[model samples]
Target chain A: MKYTGAQLVVRLLEQQGITTVAGIPGGAALPLYDALAERGSIRHVLARHEQGAGFIAQGMARASGKAAVCIASSGPGATNLVTAIADAKLDSIPLVCITGQVPLSMIGTDAFQEVDTYGISIPVTKHNYLVRNVADLLQVIPEAFRLAESGRPGPVWIDIPKDVQMASIEIDALPEPGRPDTAPCVDMDELRRAAELINAAKTPVLYLGGGIVTAGASAQAVMLAEQAGLPTTMTLMALGTMQSDHPLSLGMLGMHGARFTNYILEESDLLIVLGARFDDRAIGKAEQFCPKAAIVHVDIDAAELGKIKRPHVGIHGDVSQVLDRLLPLIQVQLRKQWLSRVSDLRSRHPLLMPGLENPRSHYGLIDAVASALDPLQADDAIITTDVGQHQMWVAQAYPFSRPRQWLTSGGLGTMGFGMPAALGAAIAEPDRTVICFSGDGSFMMNIQELATMADENANVKIILMNNQSLGMVHQQQDMFYKRRLFAVDYQRRSDFVKIAQGFGIEACDLDTAENPRAMLADALNRRGPCLIHCSIDIEAKVLPIVPPGASNTEMIGG
Target chain B: MNMRDSNINRKLNPEQSGKAVLELTVRNHPGVMSHVCGLFARRAFNVEGILCMPVGDGAQSRIWLLVREDERLPQMMSQAGKLEDVLSVARHGADHRVFEKLEEFFG
Candidate 1:
């Protein structure tokens, strides 16, 4: 059979089980788009911006735990996708990004719509390729998938020139589809040492990160915590790994964590770090964070083991496999004294939700939204958030019970992430209700996606919290910068309801509703794609905030 | 990175006396060198001297990097090894004259 490079790409993607793709088309990638049109099996969700397309694919990957694909043309199209690709790198989301390049002959001539996609993406992607020949597609396409979904998954880019995409080649059969390599064999001695450390430690904390979800090891992580009677704290990316109400679950740690959680971490004797990099945000003032704890850091990536805080037992292996072997070696202990002590601390300095009784207030608004479609009750909602105060409010108050249920950009903290990601989640899980909690500042960044959401009629209910200012920045400037607020506040407030309606989406305002709670529920319950706008107090802050360069224990408010 | 000058680059200490050389076996491709060098440049780790040439069948290349033996050198080597085109990375004493021999040519 004869196949064009574009056709082969589509076939490889089909073989990889990609039924949906999100992207925009331009000159260089016309052939790829044409091939997709001819096949007619892969449904394309047209995004308003390339960045939105990237986040949409991220949503699909983060929700499904599979490598998802995103496409863009060369030059600006490729450059726009850089942020999302970099986000995937930091968060370790699996994505295969394909872009079109100028013809090989035109590459060095500063051809129209030509930018160095391969060069620009090298620092951000796990790996990248610039396909020079049509035949190379056979190897490069499958290899891209393999690398993207392999150990310590991340984004991979494949930049095929326009000429290559139009070129044809005869082949007997397509190569086998790509699969992730088997995880590296873990050191048994390290596992033994970890087990010994856990068994011997009087006070141990199991710190889970996003890798737990990627490795499909949530159950194992919870089991490890229960078996060893270890109090568990989650990084922002690992919010849903342990159920919020679990006896030992410490919601989230560091930065905006509960005062008690940080205090407990400060006193722990040993820390069993799994699938988590000790990020600056998660481990404030590293030298002062859990200073007394002997860390047992286990990650699939060897480079991450000592990249931040060094570990007493550094085990480089997949978290799931390590837990599988280590579970049997562990001695089941109740550690009643430590449990009681933790309870006492939690009771004294809990996460203070001040405005939780009034729906008009920030925390109360999040609480009301959760009450509207309680995922804990319905078992079918995927919550996503944009960066800033609203994201933190949801992270702090939303009842996330399972991994993938919470899909926020925890690492890169990109602003315009929520709406498109919500659309992608809705597209991937049509039956599940997807809610995007966004701030006015973040919402405007990708407000154009509302048109796409309306076109698809994606089951997304965007609860936009309009503050008219970047609340986090305002708070920081107020506290840290002596109230020298500069570009944080918008001089003109946007009417988001009218904007949503203009984009053909159903929109309502809680500010005008007499009973906001009932109105929110009504809007959320009957949503194909709707925007529920609620004005927020600009002065409200996401409390228990650790100052930038201070230790977690130095948080000023709760 | 010059961790000796900054406290944030902790654990990845740069000791002036502990200079070393890194030899990498990589796939002969356009961007493989960028991938390796970008990793160092991101951390501001300087490569004082460098040499690269296609090996036996021309399908692969060997790159020798002259660098300070930062405490984070092991971690950096592991990161380099993770690159798709990098096949192997070996460390040698700074006395290795691979770059030394190229100095006259560069001059």
Candidate 2:
């Protein structure tokens, strides 16, 4: 078969089962766009910005659990897409970034619109290739896609020079590259030692992380926890690994985690950590963290076993598979005394706010909004949150009982992540309703994404917790900087309702906490991408705070 | 809170001892460092000092960790060697015989 480099890309993409592509047309990438125009089978959306294009592809990939593709031109266009590529890499979202490079001859001569995109994205991508010959284009394109979707799942870059786009390629069939096997044999001796340690410990706790969901090990992690009768504390990314409402589940741990979860981690005799590496945001102090516990670290990536703190026993294997092996060896029983102590802490420090009792606090509004979405439980409603006070509040208040139900920016506290990430989540699973919870500050960063949500007719419910200020930063400044409120507070608020209307979506205002129940009910009932502007207290802050560099004992309550 | 009581408590609890420094180089990719550090955290290894710097080229980066653990130093090196992105692992401390021999010859 004979084809141009552009046609070869489209054909290779089709072979990968990619039905949708997101990008914008520009000088360098024009030929490829022209090539895509000839193909009627594939769907392409011209996003407003190169960054948006990358994010849209990310959204599609994240939602569908498939490899999503995004294309960009050379120079500034490729640079703009770098953020989303970095985001995909950080979140382990499978994405293929195809960018048009300057023509081969003009590559290093500093041409009008030239950029070394492949070099720029090396540290951020799993693998990247700059195709020099047209013959290699067909092979490289599919190879990049395969490398991106396989293994731990991350973005890959394929940089095609402009000349390569116009060059002809002769190919009978696109040969598939051999993939190195990621599934290594588990060390059974280590697994046996892990189980023996858990069985002998009077009180053992299961610390789960994002790996649980990424590797589809939630069931196994839960089984091991249950078999050992251990209480489970999840990292933010690991929400829904175990039911939040389960008696043995302690919800999130570390900074802004539930008091009971932190208490259990600090006091447990043995901690069986699965697929979770100790992140500072998750484990505040290395020296003081799990002070009394001997740790059993089990992870597919063996490097994570003792790189943070040394584990008593390190088992290298797939989290789910290892848990399955370890379950049979654990003595089936709960440590009654340990359970009682943890239960006491759970009740005493239950996730709630006294101010919420008045039904006027920001806490009350969040609770009401969460309650309204409860009916969608049967339909599998998903929530994605941006960072700041609201994100922490939602983590504490929202009850997520299913795995992969809560998608938020846990590793990187990128504010604008909520909307695009939610849009991606919704696109991945169309049957599920994706709710984006953003602070006033976070919403403004990626407000343009509302149009993408509208264009796609996604059933995404956007909850804007409008506080008229950067609540988190403002609180820190106010408390720590002697009430010196600088530019943190936004004097004027944009009418989000009008903004949603401009995007051709329905919008409503739940001005006060008292009226959240009614507004949420209405939004939940009729929704094809609707925004709920819930007014909240500007002074609200995530409390029971552990001041920076301070011990947990130095926590201050709200 | 006085110094006298803290010293007395230290005397009563002497098990908290031993420190070693280990250096690791991993591919400069997203979450490679996070995955490595997360392992350290899970093991409850006390990190005395840690420093990370990118190599001039983007291919790899270096991480230095000062750990306070007696029996777990070998385990940490073995784990570091297992990471997918890790290029090389080396331990440098008075405790490790390899480093001690090199030091003895050089000195």
Candidate 3:
């Protein structure tokens, strides 16, 4: 059988069970797009920009816990995808990004629309390939998927020249679809030691991160917490790993975390750290963080073990596997004294929501939207947030149900991630209503995706918190930079409702609504795609912020 | 400044030469070297000397690096090992003969 390289790529993607892809077609990518149009097996989402396409792919990957694909033309197209790919790497999302390159004959002549996509993507990707031969596509395509979604998933890039895309290949049979490499075998000694530490410790805390979600070990994590009578705290990435209202749950910890969470961590003697890298935003001053605790860190990637806080026992294995073996070894305990102490700390330094009752306020807006959509016990909403004060507030106040229910740019903190990502989530799961909680500054970053949303008619509701400024930056300037506030506040307020309507989606302004809560219900309930804009106070801040370079215990405000 | 002088500035006891060698076995691919070097450069880890030769069957290569030993060497080694192209990493003292033998050619 004969197939062109472009057809081979599509066929391989189909074999990998990729029914959908997001990308922008360009001059270099024309042949691939032609094959895509002809093949008609895959659903191709036409994004306004290459970056938007990349994030859409990321959204699908993040929300579904599956490897997703994105495509781009060479040169500027590949450059635009750098942030999204980097974002995936940092957050450990499974992504395969394929870019079109100049013809092999053009090589180093600085040909039109040509860029070293493979070279540019190296640091940002887990692995990258530049296919020099048409025949190599058979191996390269499957290898890209395997490397991408394997243990400790991350983005992989494959740059194929235009000539290669047009070249023909004859094969007896197509290669098998790639799958994730098996997780590392857990060591019994490490498991016994970890269980022994948990069994013996009087004051133990279970720290969860995004890896918990990736490993699908949330049930085990929560089980261990209950069985061991351990207090649990999640990083922003690990939200929904333990339900927000679970008794053991201490909520998100570190910068912008609850005051009691950090305080409790300080008092703990053992920290069972699972699948979480000690990111600066999550750990604050590394040396000062959990100073009293002996840590037992378990991660799939061996490299992450000693990279951050050195663990007393570092287990390099899948979190689920480690927990499965370790759970039975742990002796059940109900630490009444520790629980009583945690209760005392919680009562003393609880997370304070100042304007929570006011529907127009930051925290209130998030809560109101959540309740208005799925007020009952039904869990039908997927929440994505752009990075800002709004993101933190949602993290603090939103009642997350389970893992993969909430998606946000946790590591890279890219501003333009929310809208396109929400669209992609909606595209991936059409029955679920996807909400993008975006600030004015962040919403403007990929506001063009509103048109794409309208085209797809995806079920997405954009809750725009229009502070008319970069809220997080403004708050930092106010607290740290002597209130200079330069470049943080926007001089002009753009009418987002008008903009959303102009993009051919339904729009409503909460500022004008007599009953904002009712209006929220109306917009969310009847949403194919809609923008709900509400003006928030510029002075509103995500409090309990651990000032940069300061210890988590030394947080300034709440 | 000598190694002892710098170690003194950092308030640590100076070790012998403060140098170490790393030997990496990697897949022989066009960008494998760049991937290895890029990890070092991005993390601000210094590589003092470098050499690579394709090993048996031309499908794999062995690379040797002379680097100033620091507390970050373990972390650097872990990061290097995480690269897809790299198969294994072995650490040696600065006295390793790979770079020592190449000194004569340079001279």
Candidate 4:
């Protein structure tokens, strides 16, 4: 069958087993859309915003473990996909973004609806190509897919000039993606030294990071953790690597992490950090972080080993491969005494819920909301959070079992990220219940994402913690800013339940505990999308905050 | 200062083997550091760290490289030069004035 360059891209995607696409058609990209529309098998999802499209693709990629595709037209459409692309790049989500460009002749001339998409997307994407010739179109498709999915997956951009798309091409076969040879060499001697450290330390803590997930070494990580019987705590990006309910798992580590995780990091004699960098968020004060511990940093990216905090033993290679070689030589012994000490800390700082009798407290409401979740299947449900007080609450309360189930803007504390990300997550994993935990200020950022959910009929439950204020900022101001509420008060009384209903989404309001649990359970169990608006106290505070420039020990909450 | 395209075919025999140079233009940005290094990753090409200076009205930058023979020279250089803030791209070696002085001095 004869095909144009536009049709070949779709054909290439179909050949690679892509069953779905998320995009909006504009004039410059109409031909490609026309080709897609002509194909009856591929499911195309229309996203309200181009950024939303990219994120939905991201969600799909994250859930399905394959490269998800998103498309956009020239100018603003292509530009709008930038943030999600960047997000995918940082988080290492595999995505292929196909964007329309102005005709080749008009590229540098600033023609109508044109943008230097290839140039603009360079830094944001893993690999990108501008199809200047029709003959290159076929090669660009497979190359983009290869680059996006191989060796630490990331988003790749293919900016196809309109003329190239319209041009006819005789393609034989797509070029097989060449293997990248960039991984840093691992020295067996250094690996043996790291193993020696693990074997010698009595109170060793495994601080896992996003690298484990990026390296797809969760199984290997589990083996290493279980074999050594060392307790594990993960960074925000490392959530879902170890089942939250697992005996050794201490959920998220760092500022908002479990008290036990921090205490262990502070007291442990050794820290075996896997695929995790010492980011400020994870290590509150770099100089003081893990001061007592001799760090064994294992990662694929050699640059990350001692870039932030010094590591006594740096093992560079793929986490899975390195762990495979190291685990067998180590002795199997549980650190029972250290584990007992950590458990004691866990009880002492158990999420710090407000006293039950305090009717005005927001913590009770948060706990109650958390309690309403289906405890039996809670592990299966995915929780996505926007950055704020609610995010900390969810991190502390929600029990996430699997890796990649808890999605948040960890690398970039992007507000308004939760709702869209949840919608994307739900579309990606249709069977699993995807929940969006967002505060009023955060939910307002990309509130329009609700329309996208309603349109897609996604099984996403948006739990808006309506505090009517920027809770985090308000709490800081209430404590530090002399109670000078200033502009933190979101006193504008807007009824979200009504607004959601107006948008044609199933909506409910929970003001009383009489049936809150049942209502929540039912809402999460619903077939399509639903919104649960809770009237939370505006002055609520997420405590244990280490004020700016202060040490971790100087936390607001005892 | 020794920057030339590394795409030219080279003899595989030990007696004929020699180093080739590559010049790359990249956008001046925060993470451009990694993006530049990543180009040489699996190409059997070793890049001695880029010697870069601000150019193109302070918006763009040029990366000078002393590289070994690699097949991806054109693709890598073009890809790097296509970065957001990149203005233009070219390779300079013994024939170019800037690189010639350095080549002569090293020789």
lDDT of each candidate versus the true structure: 0.91, 0.77, 0.91, 0.75
RMSD each, Å: 2.3, 6.9, 2.6, 8.9
Off by over 4 Å in 2: A177-180, A355-361, A374-379, A512-515, B1-107
Query: What TM-score is obtained for chain B in each of the predicted models?
Result: 0.80, 0.67, 0.86, 0.55
- Candidate 1, B1-107: lDDT as tens digits: 12232345544544445679999999998888888889899978888877899999999999999998766787789888888899999999988988778778887
The TM-scores, chain A only, for the candidates as listed are 0.99, 0.94, 0.99, 0.93
Query: Sorted on DockQ, highest at the top, how do the candidates line up?
Result: 1, 3, 2, 4
- Where model 3 places Cα greater than 4 Å from the true spot, the runs are A376-378, B1-13
In model 4, which regions exceed 4 Å deviation? Answer: A174-186, A355-376, A479-483, A512-514, B1-107
* Candidate 2 TM-score versus the reference: 0.83
Q: Global CA lDDT of candidate 2, please?
A: 0.77
Model number 2 iRMSD: 11.0
* DockQ of model 2 vs. true complex: 0.08
- Order of models, best TM-score first: 3, 1, 2, 4
TM-score, second chain, candidate 1:
0.80
Q: In candidate 3, how many Å is residue A401 off?
A: 1.1
lDDT of 4 by residue, B1-107 (tens): 00111223233344435444555566665445555665456434577535677677855667777654344454456555534334555654423444545666566
Estimate the TM-score for candidate 3.
0.98
TM-score per candidate, chains pooled: 0.97, 0.83, 0.98, 0.82
